[model samples]
Structures are given as C-alpha cells and as structure tokens.
Target: MWGTSRWVRRMAQGLVLIASAGLAGAALAGPTLTIGAIVPQSWPSTAEGEELVLGMQLAIKTWPGQPAPTLVIKDSACDPRKAENAARELVAAKVDLVLGSWCAIGIAPRVVAEAGLPFVSANAERLPKAPDGVLQLGRIELYIVEKLAADLRAATGLRVGGRTSCWMNFEPVLREQYDAVLCPVLGFDKKRWEQAEATFTAAHRRPFTASVARGYAAMEAGLAQLRRIRGGKSASNDPIMTIFGPLPPTDVPAQADAMQLVLSPKLPKLSPRDQAAVTQLLQTKACTCLADNSCSKPGPWADQPFVVRGNVPKCPTLAAASPR
Candidate 1:
C-alpha cells in the first residue's frame, strides 16, 4: 500500500511540471503587454469616430521596434457613462497603455491616466492638465477658422472673405478642445470675428449644425451664392479665389460633407489640400499675410501647395502666381 501511494504522488508531480512548462511557453509566445482602445463603434455620427480604431492600428504598424503591445478594442460609442464602464474593464484587464475616445469622451483616458498608465489621445481637445503619461495629438478650430478666412481671402481676393461661422462661445471652446496647434494662432479678441459671424449667421446657415453648435458652412455657401447672384467681380463670388473667415453659418449638407481637414480643437495642421488651398489663396493676389513682411522671408506656412500634388486642376490664381 505504501509503494502504490508513492507512485501516484510521483505521477502527479510530473503532470504539474508539464502543465507549468506549457503555460510558460504560451506566455512567451503571446504579447508581453496589452493596449486597450476605447472608441465609438456607433452612434453620434460614426464617421469621425470610426478613425479611432484605424489610427491605433496604424500606430501599431509603425511601432515594430517597441515591444509589440496587444490591442484590445472596446466601444464606448462616444457615450460618457459607457466610456467610464469601459475604463473600469480595461483597468481590470491590466493593460499597459490605452488609446481611445478620439472624439472628446474626456473620462476614458482620464481613468487610464489616473491608474498611472500610459495613454495617447487623438482627441478631446479640451483635455486639461492631464497626468504626465498622457499625450494629445492634432490642431485646433481657431486656426481652421482663421485659416478658412485666410484661404478664402487668398483664393478669392475678398478682404473680409465670408462668414459661415457658428459664433457661440461654446462652439469655439469646443473647437479649441479638439486642437492644440491653433492655440498660437487664434486671435485674442474674436469679438469682431464674432460680430462678423453674427452678421453672417443672420444671413445664412452652417453645416454639421448639430447638438453642439451651428454650422459655419451655411453662411459660407450662401455668401458664395449671393455673391454670384449679385454679379460682383470681387473674388469672394468665386470662393475658389478667396481666403474666407474664422467661420460663417452653415446648414447640414444633404450628404454629410467629407471632412475637409483634421482639427485638434486647438490648432490647425493643414491637410495637404488645405495647404494647397492656403498656398493657392496666397497666390491669388489676396494674401495679406504675405504682405506683412514677416511672410516675405520664408516664414512658417510657406511651402504649402495650392493644388493636390501630381494632379493639375485649373487654379487660375496659382497660374497667376507662377512666373511665365
């Protein structure tokens, strides 16, 4: 009876060793660290929020040298409450870093950061004084609004350009929260811009005019239309010739308008087309910024192309700037 018991004990010990070895091998084969992504899968205009997942995937593809982090994606659908719940789950999962809520669900990364985890946020431009481990990316709305004015003026030769701006205070604040780069460029006093916006708003509508604010596009398009109807020769009628304004009023489009540029709610990172748009605006004999003398010395905002490179669309303004 003693001999039989000893044999059974030896067998059990061997089995345990094998199991432990197998588990170690599996751990070695799997990702050493995990990254959680909280994003909106649906609701609240899925178009902009959908890029949250894609951007992280792109980041992963770019980070081969770094210890490849395992990505776990959770959908918060741009909801604040659900995002908090998702944050708790990720914390429980013991993720090393988090990327999420590309569209201003401020609580998601705050939870991660509070947990002392590393996080990268593509949005929530108003995210204030995050913990040391957090980094926010992109530009803001004032720059876009300001650039819109510049681009329109440069393109159309209209001194005042157009106003399709949603002039409410929260609207600009919301725009600022999404972008950081525009912090340097946004005018300190937007009162005149606001007054212009009011004048424009009273006249037309803006686009994407949703729960947050009115659209700047409605007034923009209306100004274009009215200018054309009036048969005025100032380039504002041509839109393509002007560097318009901070923003005008807008009406939502029949089809959702394609995002013309990426914003940070704070700064402007001119997209290639936007750069070209601004550059072309400069070429239109309407670029007042260039006349400021500082611009003549190849300052910033130079090297912006007016046409999408490798595609030659007819921009008479650019042709005019190109020396014959």
Candidate 2:
C-alpha cells in the first residue's frame, strides 16, 4: 500500500507540471494586441457610451482572425477629470491603442497621445491640430456645414450660408426658420446595416444609434492597423505614424456617407405651393458643376466656406435654372 501511495504522488506531480507548461504556452500564444476604450459610463451619456462599447464588442466578436485582440474598457463618466483618469488607467494597463468617444473628447486624447499610444477620437466633431499620434475617425462638423450650404444653394437657386449647431438639441422650430436641414443617413450597405441592427438589438435590447456606429468603425480601424503591423506592411516603423498615416485605398465602400439634405418633419406642414417647390428643388439633380469643373467659368459657389472634395453629379437643372 505504501509503494502504491508513493507512485500516485509522483503521477500527480507530473500532471501538475504538464498543466503548468500548457498554461504558460497558452499565455504566450494569447492575443498580441490589447485595445483600450474610454467612454461615458455615468450621467447623461451613459446610454450612448454603453451602445458604443457594445459596438466595439460586436466588431471584435465578428473579426475573422486566428488570435483575437483583447479589449479593455474604462469609464469617463462624461467628465473631463474622469476622462483623463480613464486614459491614465488605460496607459498603465499598457494598451496598444486607445479609442475615445463623447466623454473622452478633450483631455483623453491628449493623455493617450502623451503616453505614446495612438488615440482614435471616434466621435469628435473637430480636433485641434496635434501630432499624428492623435487622429479622428468621424465626419467633422465643417463638412456637414459645407454640405448643407451647398445643398441649400443648389435647391433654392439662392445664396445660402450655414452655421454649426448642436444637432442633438435641434428643435422643429429651428427647422421652420431654416430653408433646409441636414440629416445623417447610415451610409453602410443595406445588408450589413441590417445585420448590425439585428445583432445590436439582440444584445442590448435597444435600437442602435450613430454613437454605436462610430464605436464599430473605430474598432474596425484599430484592427486594420494591427493587421498591418503584424503583416509588416506598415509604412513606418513607428506605430503612431503607421496608424495615422494616409490609409491605402480599398474597394470597400465607406460605412458612412456625407450628410444628406432632408426636409424637416415638423408639424403644421408647409403650404401647397411651398411644398411643391421644395419637392421639385430636392428632386432636381445636385449641382456638380463646381465639383466636376463642368462650369464654363468659376462662380460664387466655388468660394465655399470650407474646402470640399470629390466630384458631384453634373447639375443640369441648376444650370438651366441659374439666372444667366
């Protein structure tokens, strides 16, 4: 019996050693990239923050890779101090990249950049001039403002101007005052959007919003950078430059398109004549003369408040309607 006990003890020790080696191997084989996210977890923006995190999670879950990236999330609580603190925590955790949303707007980017981590401002409308380490991912307000002005001028045949406002606080009364309003349209492929919606709804039991879309796009960009690094295809040895450098063109269409002009849904509808005029104007082809260089000479439209790029469809109707 004593000999049998000794043999059993030896067997147990051997098994323990093998298990330890397996665990160490697994740890060594774990994910190479760790992504950190700073988002609001408390206060008024809690819902948006949660949805954004969910979007990031969805992106990771859907990634088709051998070793998936790890995600570490910190809460900013929509406060400047908290955002800074969250960024510091992520830095201490040694994350490879950092993504920030609404609450992380101002200080978080600076903190992450200073820590030598690439910071992606997922929802910033505008970013101050900074080093390449800090980059923005979403549409800037300047584009929205310019697009609105151009659309209004094209449709109304009148000189129009645009100013930025808090879109979230936009009221129907303001729509009544303005001749045109710009609205965001999900620029994603219909099938992809449906899939995302279904997945988001199932997970969160709530409708997906633009905040979530931003989060999803942010993660997608981060993973793309990681892949480039792993493949040794990065343009620069510095990860920050590699991440913030001009992206190579891909066949995939943009997930979000430029803002689209839409009539306000305010009640007490417009008069019949006004409504018809508005409808006709909207149906008219967008003025692409400025974009396409089809115009015989430069016009006032060329003096846009902000720089606009890409060719628009030729605007035959606007040309014909223009006062020659």
Candidate 3:
C-alpha cells in the first residue's frame, strides 16, 4: 500500500511540471505589439513634433502593463509623399497601431486607412468621416468656426447677407475644412478670405500653441485609451466614446466672452494627476488663447460683434482678423 501511494504522488508531481511548462510556453508565444509614429522631425513644426514624441515616450513609460510596446518613429518630413511612404513602411513592419500627424501631411490618413490598420491622428485639420478603426485625437475646428460665426453674428447683428470673403494665410488643411464644412454650414465664403499673421516671436511662456497643445492632449488621451484596452476594460470600438465619453468636464467660465466662447473645451477632464499638470502647462508654458493676435486687441470688430479684453478683441475675429 505504501509503495502504491508513493508512486501515485510522483506521477501527480510529473503532471504538474508538464502543465507548468505548457503554460510558460504559451506565454512565451503570446503576441507582441508595435506602435508606429509618423511625424515631421525637421523644419517648421519641428519643435511641436519633438513635444509630441516626448508625450508619446511619457505615455509608454507610464503604461500600466507588463510588456512594453515597441515604438517605431518615422519622419515624414511634412511632405505628402514621405507621409505616404512612411505609412507603407509601417504597414510592411506589420505594426499593430499607428499614431501620426495628419495636419502636416495630408495623405497620411488615407494611406493608413487603406492599410486597414487602427490609426489615430494626433492632429488633423480636415478629417473626413472616420472610417472604422480610425480616430482623431485632436479637436476638429469645425465647431469652433461655427461658434465664432454665431457669436459674432449675435454680438454684431451682421448677417452673412450674400457676402463672400477670402481666407488668407490659413493652413491648407484649415482652409480646406473651412471651405468644405464651415462655409457650407455657416453660410459664408472662405475661398478668398484675407487675414494678417500675428507676430509674437518674443512672447514668453507660449509653449501651448494650438499645435503643441493638441500634441500633448493627444498623447495623454491616447495613452489612457490604450491602457483601458490593454486591461481588457474597453467596452467600445469607438476610441473617443470608450476613453473620453464618460469623463466629466473641467471648464471654468470667464467673464470675457472670448474665454467663454473662443476657448471651447477641447478635451474631457483628464485623470486627476494629468489635469493638474496640463492646467499648469497651458497657463504657464502654453497659450490657451487663439493664435490671432488682433483678436485680443481692440479692432473694428470690437465695436461690431466681438468680445474685448482691455483693448483686444477676446474671441477670434477671422476674415478681417490676423493669424498667429
């Protein structure tokens, strides 16, 4: 009896070791994930691009997971062909995810979508309807434009009244979206709008220009979504709905209609830690205001239909306004 009992125990131990080995093998064979980032590493938006990469790095470092992802950074040179080629290379690399700067390179979204990969643009000025598995991390300016027109009309009582104007010095993507979405919806002509460019080369603590803020916000929001998905807590395929849909608003109304009107909240409330950090960054390092220097200064629009801070128009006054 004693011999039989000893033999049974030995067999059980052998089975346990085999099962453990099988489990370990399965773990070793588990899939690994790679993230591809396409950005302009040189010229013009280079500073903003670098900030974007830093944000991505921060996200990866603070990821709430075991195995970290592999990030493959590709430079698109802010050129359409280069952006397309970068997308192709990422596809060839079999990257599972892609993050890109679509504002600088127009062809990025289309190429990424054609690859049928999950893509998120950290900044996009002219987005078409989101195809499945594609998302934009930054705020689309469509609503902002609409609001500006409405607020201006309400403040000035000036109707579109069959008037046409040219939009000058605007970014290509911004111009396109304005022509396509805002003009049609708001009943205005942006095809020939003329505006001055605002110069604040000596302005200090202006880290959060519209582009840089978008980059930082995109990284924070994207990383939060990724963490939720990685933890198997994501309930929806819509990235926006899954990550930010339920977040509460963290906006503070200012007496200046410009703050209330022009500065629409682009992001939902971030995690408590992120909220404090971002708030400080925007207030200190970044300019939460719009890029138009004249908007904040008293102008003809000030007496027409715009909010004024001191002598500066608070809300953006485009068409006759200047670009930052």
Clashes of 3: 18
Q: How accurate locally is residue 30 in candidate 3, as Cα lDDT from 0 to 100?
A: 46
Q: What is the lDDT of residue 294 in candidate 1?
A: 32
What is the C-alpha lDDT profile of model 1 across 1-324, one tens digit per residue?
A: 999999999999999999999889876454456767676677554643443344344334434333455678787776778888888899989976666544544577678878877565543132445555454432233223356446544543333221222221112222332321111111212443344344434544532122111112212222233233234442341222111222211221111111122222222455676566545433332233343343244423343322111112232221111101
1 or 3, which is superior by TM-score? 3
Which whole-number lDDT from 0 to 100 does residue 238 have in model 2? 41
Which of the two, 1 or 2, has more lDDT? 2
Ranking by TM-score: 2, 3, 1
Q: Between candidates 2 and 3, which one is better according to TM-score? A: 2
lDDT of 2 by residue, 1-324 (tens): 999999999999999999999888876555567899887766556766677788888888877764678889888776778878888999999999988755336678888888877777765344545445665653444244566567756645433335423232111123345544443322344455566778888987887666676577678777766666566665554432211123223222222223434333332355675455443443333343445353444434333222222122333322111011
Of candidate 2, the 10-residue stretch with the lowest lDDT total is 315-324
Off by over 4 Å in 2: 1-33, 66-68, 77-81, 124-130, 141-186, 189-191, 201-206, 236-257, 260-324
- The candidate that wins on lDDT is 2
Alpha carbon lDDT at 204, candidate 3: 30
* Model 3: per-residue Cα lDDT over 170-226, one tens digit each: 121222212111221111112211110011112232332334333334444555556
